[model samples]
Target: MTLNPLSTPLCVVQATISQHGERAQLVGLSMPSAPFGTLPWQLIGLANYIVGCQTSDTAPSPETFTAHMQARATSAIPSPATLYPYTPWHDGRVRLLLDVTLGPAKVLKWPQASLVIMEQESGSGSCDWVRLSRERTAERILTRTVWEIEAEAQLLAGRLREAPDPSTSSLLEVAQKAARWARESRKAARAALTISQAARARHALRMR
Candidate 1:
């Protein structure tokens, strides 16, 4: 189904989850994009970043894309062989919304399609684009997880070293020790990623 919001330049695509191959599933997605004049890359990028899900092929039609979104919702659960969705939360309000931009392209017919659209290609650079935002979520998650673990480890180690008697160490002591180890491990991981990203940037520059 299509939900035409009063929001200018953005068409909200709302679809009931369509399923195939013995898996009856339900999914909902909200993609924010220009209803027309949007680029495929923009759509792809926005969807990937905002939704954190994988899509096959470009979005050919509104209906088909909706199906894809539905499948994403289903795969989110522990059902079968689907990739993990990049959904940050299960809340409906936070769900990814699709905004279809009506570019210069036109579709002559309707209702004959089971999918919102058929296969089509952009005329080079004609995409609805948006600067990636809040994109560091993955890196942030990694960093935070590592940092917390590392901090815990350090705390434990500090406690242990100051322990009046190492022989009397008990569960709490053991936990603090583990936390200390985790903190260190996290620190190393954070550093590795930072170094890797920097190197990657350098490599990309050289390639460019």
Candidate 2:
């Protein structure tokens, strides 16, 4: 979909939970530009690019993959393989959080992308990954999971509210909106988690 500046950008996340359910990891995609103008199909393209790069020893060039994904985006039918497992959560942008169970292959094959793992209980600490925030330097290409992102949004909104300058009004407005979105997103994330857990339970029972 074509998006304007006023339109909320869609942020897609590929999240993986461990077998023991003690920790969670996320797949972060590198964007060509700021997410403002991104299309829905392009998000799918990003996920496809990651799979293409990681699944094979020799990875396709980003350009080649972009072309391929763009072509695939034209299909009228959406593929379940490409569909995200979790319902999307909206913060400053619309977040499409996808889920998967982390398997034996823990290594990230893509050089440009990275996997960030976090404790399910603590929701703290990460190795080789950075939280998604505006203050992050341009060189870094990774983003944290939904919870962290939502927390950041709330913190930013609070800080904006504390600013004494009248000039911050517009910024504060945006921040407040983001905070509200974060809360709504959290609700969606919780619902998604419950559903995911139930589905996993069913699968385990069937395997017995």
Candidate 3:
């Protein structure tokens, strides 16, 4: 069955600033992608790992989404993650189920894809257990963050590209440069935070 785009799962992976000064809420989604379908709890497990717990149905950060949308040229999309359900038919395939909502209100409206995961029997095979592959989680988070960075970077670059289209004053040029710099700097700052946090972790580990 095709998923209603109005309510696809939004796996919110709460990124606590990585060891690389990077921060991103890696989202794992299990809508109808094209082939993967069926994994709901598994998706929850991963969500639990990243976004804490699957509490009240959370809505998209409109402000955040809006801002990102404004920078459209190279938007990396709000694609969180893909998950599917482990159906009997999906013996050797991985499956995931998600609760996704579209639009600002997420009023349940869109053509949600029910894609299937590659291969079968790929999951930890937990019924209700929240399977969190630390390695997979870390990998997904890192890759997701990089994707976001690239998207934002492209947006910033696009803005710069257009700055000269309307004849920006020297001051405007300076300001635009500063704006671009700030966006990149924020990303850098996040990396720094990650490094700082990691150093502390290592120190604590050594103390132990």
Best-fitting candidate, scored by lDDT? 2
lDDT of 2 by residue, 1-208 (tens): 4334334334443433232234444333221223221222232333444445444633434334434544544343121222223333322333332222223222333323333221111113453232332211101211222234345446546666687555445544543454454445334434544666688899999999
Candidate 1 C-alpha lDDT tens digits along 34-102: 222133222332233212221121223434444454554332111111222333132222222332221
In order of TM-score, best first, we have 2, 1, 3
After superposition, the stretches of candidate 3 with alpha carbons farther than 4 Å from their true spots are 1-29, 35-140, 144-208
Question: What lDDT does the true structure give each of the candidates?
Answer: 0.33, 0.36, 0.32
Model 3 residue 75 CA deviation (Å) reads 13
Error of 1 at 47 (Å): 28
Worst lDDT run of 10 residues, candidate 1, spans 103-112
Badly placed stretches (over 4 Å) of model 1 are 1-169
**Model 3 per-residue lDDT tens digits across residues 97-125:** 23222222111211111122222224345
lDDT order, best first, reads: 2, 1, 3
Off by over 4 Å in 2: 1-163
Where's the lowest-lDDT run of ten residues in candidate 3? 105-114
